[model samples]
Target: MPVRQLADAVERVAPRDRRVWEGRLPVAGAGGIAVKVSPVRARQLWMVVGMWDRAVRSERLRGRRIRSAAALFGRSVLEVFWDLAQAGELRALEPGPGRERALPTATLRIVRDCLGIMAGLVKPADGAVRLPSVEQPEPKATVRAEVLGEVYRGLVDLAGAGPLERDGTALSYEDRTRLLAMVCVVLDAAPRSGELAALRLGDLTAGERAVGLRRRQQKAPPNRAEEIAALAEVRPSSVRAVLWGRRHQVSEAVYQRIAAARAELEPLPEVEWYALRPGTQVALRRWLAVRERLVEPIQGGRSALWVTLVPTKAGPPGVTLRPQGLTQAFARGMTALNWVMAGQYGWEPMPTRMEQLRRAITVSPVPAEVVGK
Candidate 1:
């Protein structure tokens, strides 16, 4: 839908907002009707916010063994310990009231590894761990799906916030590519990032109409890589799914808009900020925003409360941004944040390497937003 059209619709409904209905989105859609987001959706939205932060922290460190070998592996002390604490928090959230802990196979890998890292005295040369056995299955997969939706919301918010880079600097083409590569590391190392990352351009670009994606580990035993069953198709300028048990398709134009938002993301100094170090909270602080889709930060599973969009075949999503301009200011935020919080929380000051990753394992309730709390 065009911005003007969307805006007009929102305006028409604005006056009718008096404790609207709360429920899940309908499985099927009519040609042109819009519906109020359900209560289940609102909860899911907040859960995603919380999950996004958790995934980011799990990537570069382990829980128990964080300190044993971090200075050696090149990650900072701060990053390592935070991962460990992050893991503990998730494990505790395994079964809770109003909280969830299930995640995809890839997310399972991240959470478990942090525990392994925290357990060992000497660094285990093989960096791996078995997934924790869970009594229930619902939380595991639901959280991951939630994150993909959040990624979409985040992209849209970022686009609207405009470019977020530093000034007087032009990234060499290679530098720009490298920068995006780094920014995605936070996303890639995240819970479902592995599944999303597993997407070979071939996998993403595979089908002629809608691309096909398979839900990998859901029904499979350990070591069984499930066949691709999830399907995504590329329409004229949009992507949709006519096969996921029901109708699911966004406009050709919306897809283009999302793709553009992602392209514009790389130019921001946030690309550099994320690229420079590996901290989930740091990234969240840098990019988390109050937007249409946000319910609460790390609320449960999905990173964004709404959708997840990416680049496609015909034309890369085109965007214009200026993030490089904020480099120093971001660095200062990093430093001040470290100064006030780390030591106060028992973390070592200004950790400088990657292996210093195994510290705390916390599922500390990530508030919905900077303002939401």
Candidate 2:
């Protein structure tokens, strides 16, 4: 019989009989009979066959494997049908109460079972044939604006010098700096956590017009540059400078304390220049100066842009803030903001609340003369 006719016959045969026939018959002239295979089926078949070949060569498959040329040809035909079944191209009657329902469906186990049957038909040149492994599904990405706004608000509250009380407790300076740094970087750079965490002190360049951040792309090809907008209001450069100064301040203090106890130590390195807009520069400089007097200088190389000043028993007092740590901080801040806003406003959408807040800030105070009139 011709190869195409035999393949068609195999496809039409009952499941039990088809298996019996597959074990007895051999395939030939597959190249000439390529016209019989549909494009989609052929593609899936090629993938399955390729996987089987790799498994055999890697010795992943042991014992009897598809080695006969005729059997291999017949195996390809079975593969096409198996691929169809796995892809839900074949329908089965799903027994229901009072009636039978026909639907196209294939479970993961069913697909693997069909693959196992196909594997049995082939004799590998070296090892036995093994079933193909399933590929994992990719995770879906989602963005929640309300949660983002809460995190932003938390940072703003922390950055303010005035005591910020949430639930009758004042926030610490350490919490303020960490939250502020995360908000500033994320708002300005709009980079993923990995890319943000990988940023180095040298990667930032502040020009006369704007600041530029140069870092290797985490999700793209090497050498591709990603442009990030610098919001005039956010003042990311200013935040960066403050973080740098805090680290130096902590390190200097530690050195001084050690000197008093035993011997003198080398002076800490100077903080680098971080350019900012005319309006923001003075405020940031003043903040850093005050921070120097109050906070201890940070210890370590301080090469990483993001570092936590809060002392902890887990490790060193000064440690670099990782991507995961930053994410967690942001989440916690968001949850706190949500709780506060929900209580005061009695449940409103975040966007509406933000709009109201914006309007309140932008509203100019009436003059004394206007009020008197």
Compute each candidate's TM-score over C-alphas.
0.18, 0.35
Query: How far off is residue 324 in model 2, in Å?
Result: 2.6
Model 2: per-residue lDDT, tens digit, 1-373? Answer: 2223323333432122434533433321111111222233333443444433433333223343444423433444445444544443343333467642322233444345334433333334333333444554443333354545554554465466454466654445555555555444444335455555665545443322112343322222211111110221223333232222211222444433422322232222222122334423333333334344333465552555555545554345445666666565555544444545565443443332222222222112222233231
Model 2: how large is the Cα RMSD against the reference? 24.2
User: Which residue ranges in model 2 land beyond 4 Å of their true spot?
Assistant: 1-154, 161-171, 206-299, 344-373
Query: By TM-score, who's the top model here?
Result: 2
How well is each residue in 216-247 modelled by candidate 1, as lDDT tens digits? Answer: 32223211111111112233222112111112
Question: How far off is residue 101 in model 2, in Å?
Answer: 33
For model 2, the local distance difference test gives: 0.39
Give the Cα-based TM-score of candidate 2 against the true structure: 0.35
Model 1 per-residue lDDT at 206:
14
